[model samples]
Target: MRKNKLQRQASTIDKKFLLLSLFLTVVGLVALADASAPLAQRNFGDKFFFLKQQIVWAGVGIVLLFIASKIHYRLWEKIATIIFFLSLFGMLMVFIPGIGTKLLGARRWLVLGPITIQPSEFLKLTLAIYLAKVSSKNKKLAAYFVPLILALSLIMLQPDLGTAIVVSTIGMAQLFVSGISLIYFASTLALGGVLGFILIITSEYRRDRLLTFFEQTRDPLDKSYHIRQILLALGSGGLFGVGLGQSRQKYLFLPETATDSIFAIIAEEIGFLGASILIIIIVIFVIRGFAIARASPDTFSRVLSCGIMSWIGAQTLLNIGSMVAIVPLTGIPLPFFSYGGSSLIALLIGCGILLNISKYGKE
Candidate 1:
């Protein structure tokens, strides 16, 4: 009977969810190897440096996923506050002298010797978990909303509007699914939109991005260069593409080829068909994730699953929208696909939590 129970529990795990995540991970690794080759070689004198590091991180993420999947989902609720504070501490460390690392005029990373991390990445995950726990208890809006605002203020100070937006969206989405009043929901969303607009227009670089999105001809080789190159890469892909690993743009012409603009490179190499396949996979992941959320056995698990789903789905939309010129480029990393260790790890861990919840979901 004990052996049979073990087998039954194993069967309750979401195999389709795990398979889709693995599929995306494999695709990301292959695409990063191709997209980062030229950039990595030029900067580090090694074509495979980034790819090798990414593989190591992916291995670590997989191990973490497995461990997290086996743990009880309820355990997170007990420590959600602790995790949030710890995440905040890490984010604060990024502002300290001699520890905070600045790149491209933004202070967003904490560099501790050979290990550098973006605390904001982990903060997003912890924030979602914290909010879900708070909202699950039917707490006052201030319980979740005020703290989220505080977090957003710090994130924006990092001058990372992309991450700030994504984090805020994830938190708000959790509140929405937690049975918040309709009036409160509409007001909060409107407020968020206005605040986002103000944040964008006040910052020179962000304002320029917005302006460039409207008028690409204003600064073709400067402010607008990234978007134009992205469009060119997509257009060049045509129907089938230039073929995998044959992209010319990765050779220093397109900016952020291996990071923010990797999707464009994918399109340029594998064509429209390949890009559509990726988009479809993401769509399916979102649908099935929500299905799990709906089937959750309790409020905390339901809210947590919904929050995680929003983080992945919203970020994916933002990244893809920027590349396609629908939204102004926000420098957001595509989940599972972007070449960032912290992002991939946080995402996989979230998936593991969702999987664990699936086991106890209402059948």
Candidate 2:
């Protein structure tokens, strides 16, 4: 019986999901090394500075992934509340003097001794787990929406609108998977839309981004330079590409080459063919994730799985959409591919949980 049980467990693991994630990680590391070389040398005096940091984070993320996968996922249900509050506390720390680090006008990182963290990333993951655990029990908007609003408010106050949007998307996806009524979902979406519009208009910089996205003004160099540069990078690669490690734009022609605009650099270097392959890989990841969610043996696992998939899907849409000029620039990072220790680590751990859930899925 024990041997059969072990065999059952082994057979149930989602190899497809695991393989796709590994593929993306390998692709991300390769692309990042190529994309960050020039900037790393200019800023840090080393061609591989950013690449080395990312490799270190990747190692740390792999270790966390193993631990999160080994821990029975149900324990997340027991400690979800504590995790959520701790995430919120971390968010608050971003405002503390000397501890909070500001970059590019946003105070989104907290320096805790030797380490720095972006709490919004942790908030996105923890909130998904907490909502999955609670919404599975309560099944009401009042039960989950209030805390979501509180979390969003805190995140937005950090002026990290991109992370706020991602967290909200995860919460709404969880609500839908929990069987919330259509009217309720519709109402929630509409309310969110109105609130988003208000937030965008109230901030001068956000308003400028919105305007730049919709209609280019007299000065392209001021507000819309980034978008125009992104278009130039993408368009320069007509069919195949300029060739890997040969991106012209990476030589100070474009900004954020290693972060938000990394996809554009990918396109510039590898052309449409390579970009399409990356997109196809992401599509496979999302489909497998939802399939695992559908096969989950319990409500909590199913809902959590849905939330995690939505988190990745929504971020992908935002990041790619902005790159192709279909949406405004939001400074959102492309999953696994973007250069950020916090994002990659949080995402890998989330994948670990999803993998653990897959083992218990209905075969």
Model 1 CA deviation exceeding 4 Å by range: 1-11
Clashing pairs in 1: none
> Could you give candidate 2's per-residue lDDT for residues 49-166 as a string of tens digits?
8898889998898888877877778999999999999999998888988999999999999988977888898888899999998887886667798879989999888898888889
Q: Across residues 1-363, which tens digit of lDDT does each residue of candidate 1 receive?
A: 967765676558888998998888988999999999999999999999889988988999988998899999999999999999999888888889999988998899998898789889988889988998898775788898877988898898888999988998898889898998889999999999999999988888989989999997777899999999999999999989999889999999999988999999999998999899889988998898889899998889999999899999889999999999999999999888789888999999999998998887776
> Poorest 10 consecutive residues of model 2 by lDDT?
5-14
Model 1 scores worst on lDDT over the 10 consecutive residues at: 2-11
Compared with the true structure, the alpha-carbon lDDT of candidate 2 equals: 0.89
Q: Which candidate is the best by lDDT?
A: 1
lDDT of each: 0.90, 0.89
